[model samples]
Target: MTASVLSRAGADLSTARESLARAAQRVEDLLGALPVPGLRSLEQRDRAAAAHNEVRAHRVDFMATHATEVYDELTGGRTRDLRLDELVEAAAGAFPGLVPTAGQLAVERSRAQADKEGREIDQGIFLRGVLRCDLAGPHLLTAMLRPTTRALLLLPDFQRTGLIEMEAVRLERRDGVARLTMCRQDCLNAEDERQVDDMETAVDLALLDPAVRVGLIRGGEMTHPRYQGRRVFSAGINLKKLSAGEIPLVGFLLRRELGYLHKIRRGLCPREPEQWHAPYLDKPWVGAIDTFAIGGGTQLALLFDHVIAASDAYFSLPAAREGIIPGVANLRFTRIAGARLSRQVILQGRRILATDPEAHLLVDEVVEPAAMDDAVERALTRLDGAAVVANRRMVNFAEESLADFRAYVGEFTVQQALRIYGEDVIDKVDRFSGRSE
Candidate 1:
């Protein structure tokens, strides 16, 4: 009976693979026949869009039905061992025109405008299909928690001197604490590709370091004229770069949530799978919100064990106005703040001042700007005990399980892609930048 069941499963896998391959070929042919987006008539573009949507719906259905089998086939049953980028590269190779190559993504980044005429949107849909798959989505997300190559390369030097300074982030170990500071001075420490890469590398260092018992995130002093010498937590996503099509969909949007942020919340996974349940290489993290935590920055504060905010500091998630999802905030906010307040903040662009009684949901303490340093030290000292790890794990498991996060990302994957390329994105960004007509 077991052999018979196995045989039927194999047959189903084979059928699904064949069906998807034929669908991919049809999509390729249909896209090839359509004129470039700039030259296509409205009716022609509409028809093409409909065809694209139909193919995506079919692909999503297949992925949902045969997720584990298809993913195992793609990864040679080694999905547990592969990194996120490796998995994505494998998918790109298998599907050819359906997914963007690393080089193709780089070319898109160099463009002044996002490619509405190409397969990039289709690629986003394809990725979304994979993420929406229950087992496969969480597996892929877990893969992203592994240490970055940059961090590994710099580990030896850091081990010797306990310091690392990159273009957008700096890290130093002292007194059982790993201090990771965001240093993109020009843009008030806004996150872009460079910032995310450097920050993730810094995060890997903090988690991988043997002597560190606690981690702290704070903004480095800024050089921007408006906030010169002041530490502005983060200005959030670099809208200027975003509007220029410099941020890749996978590299920034998905990578930030599944990569560094997830690592911070869940801790780093081991390179080799463990036979027994082992604690993730995690430590308590504290956020020092000196000036403001806006958008991505606010989303970040949600994951920290404790957050210390300046009395005058503020928090907001303007993702609705910005035409994008506020990185995992949707999944986390309702739990921290009640549903109504979460909606106000995320949907209505409401800002929460640190000193407000309601701000206690996100911030553990609010201190005078001059006393922020002392508040952070107190929080760190309080959290540096041995029991921090176990408590953090328990709270994380109870609040947001890996499965819950996976489901959220599944929806975010496709919805964010659409918003990123939506006509409204550029216009909204332009208005924010004072460049709109």
Candidate 2:
């Protein structure tokens, strides 16, 4: 039923695969052993077929087992109960505060969507044309059953990196107006700063890129409605299965300029934010599709100018309890939520005013979950296609005025590394150089 069970059974194919691989190597070995040209005859055809079937067995085992694993793993092990009915109910449910930002929920929805696509493809009868191999019609049929499988095979390594690289952001220009379209829904919404940064980078791509005019974001019930609203523009951060490194990576990449990174590993900030040279900030119509904008997620949503949310969006900041303060979006939250709500947010480190009208200001509009795309399109209608290019001069000046980023980070890194080392760096170097310990 699960890939785990199949994998064990598939172990037979592993041995068969290895044997076939060795069989190729042993053609010479057999020549050496027999002291003759080799065995000949009609058995050669059966032999080749056996080898091909061995390869096929391995391939089938690998494809089926791996695909099932992908589903289970990406589904957070909930694939056991993953049914179409549950997916639809969850998508339509009024959920807010369960996740911090729409980005996280967006990922969940994407998975659900993929699952639906797979089921539909499975049920369809005429999808055989696109199949690559008919030897195992089931494999071909399953490929049809899961259209996203092709996409998965194309970018087979995405499972490791936890990133979804979009070839193009959907944009529609109709009647001299521009609107964004939705891509496939599966997502990895990470609350980590680095993942937050990746999402931010994507936002700039979606909203500001001349190549993309609009993007439809999907979200989860867990996000703050304020941030979740941004799912209208793009996928928000999803915290599901995100590691600690990923959490800060999301925020750091989004907020900090990568130019600020230290040449040496700096211990000062949690991580370095990636710098993007491409111009996107000047665009006034940058939009967000956020889910679970808690802590870092909320920070990411604030980075965008436009946000569309479901009725169930939620918001909060919990970095205070972690003994480190959030430097990224708390500055903006403090201004918008005021001193009191901000205090409760950081100090209490829990959901406070997620459903309140006060949080509504963080987003431009609120709508039923189904109407999220409509809301985003409606907002895009008011834009004049103006972008802020003049600010580049000011940005250049600002960069020039700032302290040398490398040195600034290097100094802190040296101090902290030396501090943590106590006497280790010098001692190690000196010892390496044959000096006293």
Candidate 3:
């Protein structure tokens, strides 16, 4: 390489090294500044502490490894073949198992990008671009494929009215039940950015509206012959968009964490002094599942307070196949379905049938498809709204607090960002779209 080119490469390496050093210092400062876990919400504090400790360890390894690489390259030694993990491994005896791999650094980078992009997109400019883009094939095949997108673009004035008219989801309130339906029947309720936004809006409305006693989540009736007149809950995140490179993976995952899922976990109310100490939404959520809930669909179902699946309905977490984590599935599923089951489902790509014993453990009730509506109604009616609200607070306080949710999300967000932006995602998306064998 030319001297000028080598000089530029050395400069880039120096910059990367400095960035790692700064990140390590910041993580150390964060650990020092964390509040002590107290009697109330102790589990949350413990989870937070644990998450931060992991971050600290990763940062230490990252900094140490990069510093060595910078020194090696500047000392007239060839550092061309140096791997981040190899450096960390060589120093493992100094800090056992504290070795940061290339993956961890990539994850950290993604986390930074997400933080930056999250703030920039708050004004909805990027979202408008995504919704307006004509690259997605499904949206072209049938204009109905993007009802929410079209409504948002055409009638920006009446967002509420447009949201109500969204063909991807139906937000309805009747007789104290806030019914949030995952529509998009033609695609089996696959979710794109607009659909997720609509769902988040509906969820926020349900949580904020005092009159909404119980929230019911279900899929709209489908007309396709395969699922004619039946509810096909959700196929998952729109792979078509992900494959077409329309939806950037990191932003998509970040939005899910900070948007609908966060809204579902923490209401529109104020949070505690600590950024992580968000208060839980008191309203109970009931999930009415029909044909299938796949990948991200199943992740959403895991968050519901009550789940009623049709006898023929099924659930699957196919993230392993897609080369991504199912957002917070590792944390939530392990708590709900045990670590072993979560591993089998996530790592093995095992499908859990509605009638399976494992499914019963996760789902509260399994009834005939025809009886799903009645089952959901009966389930909702059995619970006294005020009592449900009170009991939810007690249950959340005793078991999973907002702090716990945030800690899991904290780890998930960064880890997901890493996968989303990494080279692995490129190949995964290619395979998913059938561009690769």
Candidate 4:
């Protein structure tokens, strides 16, 4: 009886493998026929998008239904200690045209042109499919938390001096606090690839430091004529760079969420999967909002344990007008502000002022501009006294677990990609008049 059952199970495994192989072949054929070369014309783009969507639908369905089976096959039945990039490479080889290899994606990012839009869209769709696979989604997300190559190289210097200054960000560890200041003065402290890379490296420095008990993020003084010498929390995505096709979806959108912001919220994951459930190496983060937090800036405030804002400050997520999904705001805003208000804030581009009663949802303390420094110090002291790591871990476990984040990213990956390349977004970017908001 045991031999008969084993034989049946073996047959089923063989059948599933064969089905996957055939599906992969079908995807290869479809992609080969619909070669996404430049897509110069509207008609060409539309047709290519439709073809990509079909491929995406098929891939999503297969992964959703056979996530474990697919993962098992990719890893050769070894689930433990799997690296994310390795798994991605394996998938790219096994399922040609479904996903780009890491090297290919890197090359595309380096090019950063309108001509590469189709390939970028395909990469996003492929990531969405990967994120759907429960076995792989969380792994990929966790892998992003590891320090970047730049960060790793600078670690020794940071350890020696407790300060590292990059072009767009500066980090200093002092009195048990790792202070990260955004330094894109000319752009009103807006985020771009340079800023994001520097910011992530700074965050990595803070997390890796044993003496650091808390992390703080605040914008540096701006050089824009109107806001010259004054701090502006952040102007959000650098519209100029984004409109110029300098912002690749994977490098900026995906990396910002999966990398620094996530590191700030959940801390660093253990190298071993067995230890993931254990408490992460985390510290409470504080956001010091000076003038305003707009779009991606507002999204950043949501991840902090404590947010301190100047009485005259305000926050807004104008992603609706920008024609792209605000990074993870949809998943997070509703929880803080109720569904209705969150809708107003996100969908209607409503701005919440620091002095308003409703601002309490996003800001923990509102202080006069002159008193901001004192307020931040007091908040840090309070956080230091409390069991910050324990409390944060408990709160996150209840509010946004790894599984919850994984699912949200899985869906977000595809939606944001489509929005980024949509006609409406292109039109909006063309009409942008150099306004920070």
* Predicted structure with the largest TM-score when compared to the true one: 1
What are the lDDT scores of the predictions, listed in order? 0.81, 0.36, 0.60, 0.78
Ten residues in a row with the worst lDDT in model 2? Answer: 259-268
Worst 10 residues of 1 by lDDT: 111-120
Q: How well is each residue in 347-428 modelled by candidate 3, as lDDT tens digits?
A: 9999999999888778999999778878999988876467777776677566666556545654554466456544565567
Query: Per-residue lDDT for 1-437 in model 4, tens only?
Result: 49898577657655654665566566546555653445445766576567656766665665565565556667665444343445656767765555666766765555424445345566566677667776667657766776666787998988889999999998998999999999888788778888888988899889878778899999988888898888888999887777667787777888888888888888876465665656477888999999999988999999999999999999999988888899999999998888998999889989999998899989999999999999999988888844777888789879888888888988887788888777677667656734224
1 versus 3: better lDDT goes to: 1
Ranking by TM-score: 1, 4, 3, 2
Consecutive 10-residue window with the lowest summed lDDT within model 3: 137-146
User: How would you order the candidates by lDDT, starting with the best?
Assistant: 1, 4, 3, 2
How many residue pairs clash in model 4?
Answer: 0
The clash number for model 3 is: 0
**TM-score of every candidate:** 0.92, 0.37, 0.62, 0.85
Model 2 misses residue 52 by how many Å?
61
Clashes of each: 0, 68, 0, 0
**Candidate 1 residue 123 C-alpha distance from true site, Å:** 4.2
Q: Measured by TM-score, how close is model 1 to the native structure? A: 0.92
Model 1, C-alpha of 189: deviation from truth (Å): 1.1
